[model samples]
Target: MKITALETLRTDEFANVLWVRVHTDAGVIGLGETFYGAGAVEAHIHDTLAMRLLGRNPLHIEAIHREMLNLPMAQSSTGVEHRAASAIDIALWDVFGKICGQPVHQMLGGLCRDKQRIYNTCAGYRYVRSNNIKPVSNWNLEGNEGPYEDLVGFMTRADGVAESLLESGISAMKIWPFDPAAQENQGLYISAEQMKKAIEPFEKIRKAVGDRMEIMVEFHSLWNLPAAMQIARALEPYKPTWYEDPIRMNSPQALAEYAASTNVWVCASETLGTRYAYKEYLDRGAAHVVMADLCWTGGLTEGRKIAAMAETYHRPFAPHDCIGPVGFIAAIHASFSQPNTLIQESVRAFYTGWYNELVTTMPVIKDGYVYPMEGPGLGVELLPAVFERTDLTVRRSSL
Candidate 1:
């Protein structure tokens, strides 16, 4: 069957727009999630990529992918081009999977493990409250006022939340001190006293949890190298499972320096896209852990390739999940099919009722591990009405 139509659907949820709903003529369609802040990708999807996709065989994913890359659609490669390529790639895979009557993971080489382990990120919301700081722009999930009440409000609620996540059988959680108040301090050289103060919440949690959970410190690329090193040194005693994006992701050499200096595992690459972008980091031994985002790092097609590349370096891969259900499921397919995958990032924000409107099947989280659907393709369907609640528009055009 040939491609019939390509669509770009935008949603108002998270104040974000994800490209969705690729259509083909053989009574099959595929869905994909484009990441946040890549509207140029959506424009390319309409103005450039659509021309190459129309009338092409959906099953020829690699050839279509190669053509898209070489098609001179853009003067440079950035998240926008990658996001456009990723959405189309994911849709093609979904179509191919439907045609083959198998899940995407099976098509990738079958399951490495029946279930994937997930680390919670929603737990990070409390760090803002406990520190008595106002939430910053983009830090609050809802984009509203103060996220939590106060330190006591945060502490009391945080315990119950952790207990609930633990009870749900989640083994690991990621907490970020990503308050807006903290953003101004980011990338600035912080004093040792400030670094110590920044780490107090993690120290307290480690003492309370006592090794029962893995805490991943996310700086959001806020600290300079020296400050990051100092903070890493201070938190070394607590034994965080990983330190995420301590320094900026702009240079492999900078990341390498931090990795070389810290005993804590350095994780990077959520901002990175495609194999070419990941190569420098791998060659330089820049990171101990590679965190690839399915939505941001070229979807499952490129994410799996990146995972393979990371495996050659003997590093663990944790597919990043920070968006909607489509991103989560696509990441799961990649993670399930890769043996070297360390953990998958997730949050209650998506899995709970809030995300239910976006898709039919909730990610199966049992006892800290996620299970890919035995169903076909991505195996999740979004109800048509859900889009109605979202102030999103879908338009498809061909060059």
Candidate 2:
């Protein structure tokens, strides 16, 4: 069956996350969600890539992915073009799974294990609520409740936060206490005082939980090589899961140098666009673990390829999911299908909070592990009430 229409829907209530609906000549319609820049990604979907998808077989996911990126302006980058293609590819995969009467993870390759382990990225309810991604210093969101509170608490109360996640049966947690310094210093340098302040949480977590919990430090790609190297070397004693995106991902040579400077493994960026970008990081030995955001890295079609490529290099693959609900579920599908996958990222703030407000299916995370998602396609859809919100915006293109 061919695509009859492509439509984008958004609500200011959710702000930055946009949903796409791919209508087929058959009765089924597939759903996809993408995070960041809803307005720009929406325009790219309709004005730039919709024509290429309008009459195509919805099951030709790879070909359609290429067609969407074949335009000279769209090629070889992970910008708006790839983001638009990613959402469409996810929708098409939903269609493919529906056609085969299977869940997306089953369609990918069937589950390799009963469940996958996960790590929580400490973030507040209001984190990434807008298109602008500058790090936030304040944790004072209006809805900071007792059971579900701790946006920036990872820094101030590392011990309490660790205890809380352990209570949920989650054993791994990720935090980025050094980012506010990078933002202030332009990633150029971290003074001794700043370095001491940043290491406080690491010290606290190590003191509180000992080796019972796995801690991952996120640099948010907000440091220069010198500062990143200094931070990386300083944290080697704590033994973080990996120093993630410590510096920018623009150059593999610099990252390789930083990786060589310390024993700590480097987990590279999820902001990269395509497999070629990941290849550069891999071939250069810049990163020990390769990460991809399925939503931004050309969806599951491309995420699967990246996973295989990481396998070829003997590197563990991890899918990034600090985005919307549908993308979070899509990442879990990719995580289960790939044999080399190490773990997946999730935020209790997102999963236990806003994620429920937008979608029907919530991933099963308990005892520090996430079970393979059940049901056909992505196993989730926009809540029907989402469409009725007064702040919604929609645009459509048809064959």
Q: Best-fitting candidate, measured by TM-score?
A: 2
The sequence of per-residue lDDT tens digits that candidate 1 reaches over residues 71-108 is: 65432243677777777888888887888899989988
Candidate 2, residue 282: the lDDT equals 93
Give the per-residue lDDT digits (tens) of candidate 2, residues 156-209. Answer: 798899988888888888898898788888889999999999999989988999
Candidate 2 RMSD computed on C-alpha atoms after optimal superposition onto the true structure: 1.3
Task: Give the deviation of candidate 1 from the true structure as CA RMSD.
Answer: 4.1
Question: What residue pairs clash in candidate 2, if any at all?
Answer: 169-368
> Which portions of model 1 miss their true places by more than 4 Å?
71-78, 123-135, 141-161, 178-182
TM-score of each predicted structure versus truth:
0.89, 0.97
lDDT of predicted model 2? 0.87
Q: Using lDDT as the measure, which candidate wins?
A: 2
Model 2 TM-score is 0.97
